[model samples]
Target: MIRIVITGITGRMGSTLLRLARDTADLRVVGATERPGSSAVGLDAGLAARLGALEVQVVDDLGRALDAAKADVVIDFTGAEVSVGHAKACAARGVAFVCGSTGFSPEGLAELAVCAKTVPIVAAPNMSVGVNLVIRVAAELARVLGPGFDVEVLEAHHRMKKDAPSGTALRLAEVLTASLGRTQEDLTFSRHGQIGARPAQEIGVQTLRGGDVVGEHTVYFFGEGERIELTHRATSRDQFGLGALRAARWVVGRPPGLYDMADVLGFQGNS
Candidate 1:
């Protein structure tokens, strides 16, 4: 069995992960954590997730969780800074790390890279397998469509989401830029009045908020009288939780390095 810890155990993704892990045969929830001073602390993790009690109490610190559980891996769905700290803790303990947190700054990603030198780390903005497949297809579309098509990405999420232009949208943008041999400098996040015709090489990304919507992303490649749109809509958060579990199972016993869902899904060469 793979012993795992869930960070941010009370959040949407964490709670979902806890319940799924409890139901999975080969996966075991060895520990769980929440932010300091969270009300969920001290409660049985399964109960906090409304899954009854699993005899594992949610703690305030990841270090304490790791110490108590002796986990082989940590599944995190917290914010960027918090996830980085969790990665460091897991690295120190020689544990593999899987995080689906977004909005990581350059320095934050650098820290994760450093941590990956000691322990395997799988970090992806969106952990849903369908979304990763969409990302891979977006790259292929960008390559096949060529510069003749004007590219634009539009994404929508729940208003409570803190990050604008959701990480998945940015990941799509990254792949498009890489596949097309264009730089991020070609990215255009906004368009205002007095803006002239769209630049030939520019890739536009737009954001939408204010909804109970889970998550949605669409990549548009517009050509003369024709457009191709690749879209993925997340109806529930369970796909992400399940994907994290899949990553947790795949990451254990792997070599130390930074990996993404593409790696876990075996899309490395094609993606």
Candidate 2:
């Protein structure tokens, strides 16, 4: 079994990852991390997940957890604030890293990237295989359909999701923008009172949050004759957990570099 180190062991995705690891035969939980002074720290990870005792302890220090657990790979679902540190620590220990965190600023992303030079890193805003496929197809549609088709991305998540438009939506916009040879400024978050007609060059991203929506993204390519809509909806968070587990399993023994779900799923999109 591959020894898995999980960060943010008490969070939603972290807990889901823990529970999923229980059923995965090739995987085993070795260590878990939480923030300093969090009440959940020091709890038995398996017991915390209601999986009885797997003999893994949840602690606050990521470095200590890795050393104590002798982790082979770390699956991080923590936020931007802590994930960079986790990546750095894992790389120092020669441990593979998989990050499913969101809301990372440019500097934060750069910090996480530095570790890829030493250890394999799989970083994706959304880890679900279906979402990655949707991005590939969206890029293909954008390339084949050309700029005549205006693109818009619509996303919805739970009310507690802090980031607007969602990271997955932004990723889709990036894929479409890159395929169409457009700039980041081409993304339009909202069209309000003063904004008149939709700019032909702009791609709109709209967001909706309510009623604990797991996650939903729809890409609309509006053309004169025919329009195409590509969509993916997550009925449960276990999909993300499962995808992360696969990434954790695949990243080990690979070259030191930054990768994504496309690399994990082996989907080749014409970039």
Candidate 3:
């Protein structure tokens, strides 16, 4: 069995992951954790009725939790700050890490890469398989459509989401830029004032926030004569939780490096 430790045991994704992990054939939940001072500390891994009963308890000391459990892989659905510590602990113990955390600082990502040198790490902003596939298709569209089409990405999330544009949006931009041979610094995030016509070399990003929208993303490729739009709407968080679990299973006993969902789904030409 693939022994796994889960961080953020009380959060939305954490609860969902716990429930999903129960159904996974070859994976077992060895441990679960919460940040220091969290109300969830000492709660059952199943989150007190949110999920059915699980034997594990949600603790604050990640190192102690992982060491005691001897987990082979650590799945982190925590925030960026907590995930850094989890990565460091997992790296020191040669434990593979699968992270669904987003909005990491540059220094945090640098630390994660360093950790990857010691144990495999799969980190992604969004863990939905369909979203990653959308990224792949968006890249192809960017390549074939060329500068003739104006590219715009629109994303919507729950009002509780902390990051604008979402991690999926940024990843989509990364793929599109690589396909078009441009850099993210060249893209446009907003247009309010008397901004002239849209630049052929720039991609536009827009965001919407409202009640209980799980997640939604749409990419528009527009030209003078035609326009094409591709979209992915997430109805539940279970999709992301399941995808993260799938990645955790795949990264077990693998070599050290950072990876993404594209790698999990075998998307061709991904770097």
Candidate 4:
């Protein structure tokens, strides 16, 4: 069985991961961590996740937990501020990592990549299989449709979601921009006031947050006579939890490197 360490164990995604890992045939939850001072610390990770008790306690000290558990891999669904630290800690211990955290700045990502040079790391803004497939499809559609088509991204999430536009939406925009050879400067986050006619190469990204919507993203490629929309809506977090677990399974026993869902899913073109 794959012995696992789960970080951010009390959060929505993290809790879901805990339940899924318990149910998965080849996985075991050996350790879990939460941010320092969080009330969830000191609780049995499984019990807190409603899985009764597997004797895995959630601690705030990640390094100590990893060492104590003899964990094979760590799955992180924490926030950006702590995510890099967790990666670096895992790398220092020569433990593989699977991160599903979002809202990381470019520099944060670069830091994670540096950490990956020491330990296998699979990090993605979103870990749902459909989201990964949709991003790839978006790239392909943008490539085929050419620059004549205007690209726009729309994404919605629960009110508690920390990041606006959602990391997955930004990733889809990145794919669209890359496929069309448009750089970050060509992107427009909003069109308030008199933004004037949309620039010929502009890519628009919009956001919405309310209620308990799991997640939704729609990418539009608009041309003069026709338009194409590619969308994915996640009704629950189970798929993402499963995807992260799959990534955890794949990252173990591999050489040090950074990977994503595309790698886990066997999409060679993106990898």
All models: lDDT?
0.94, 0.90, 0.87, 0.90
All candidates in order of lDDT, best leading: 1, 4, 2, 3
The per-residue C-alpha lDDT of model 1 at residue 54 equals: 97
| Regions of candidate 3 where Cα sits further than 4 Å from its true position | 47-49
lDDT digits (tens) for residues 6-41 of candidate 3: 887778898788888888888899898887898878
Q: Would you give me the overall lDDT of model 4?
A: 0.90
Predicted candidate 1 versus true structure: per-residue lDDT over 1-271, tens digit per residue: 9999998888999999998999999999999999989989999999888889999999999999998877999999899989999999999999999999999999999999999999999999999999999999999999998889999999999989999889999999999999888999999998889999888999999999977889999999999999898999999999999999999999999999999999999986654
Scored against the true structure, residue 88 in model 1 reaches a CA lDDT of 93
Q: How close is candidate 2 to the true structure, as a TM-score?
A: 0.96
Give stretches of model 2 more than 4 Å off.
none
The lDDT leader among the candidates is: 1
Candidate 3 clash pair list: none
How displaced is residue 213 in candidate 1, in Å?
A: 1.1
- In model 3, the worst 10-residue window by lDDT is 44-53
Best by TM-score: 1
The collision pairs in model 1 are none
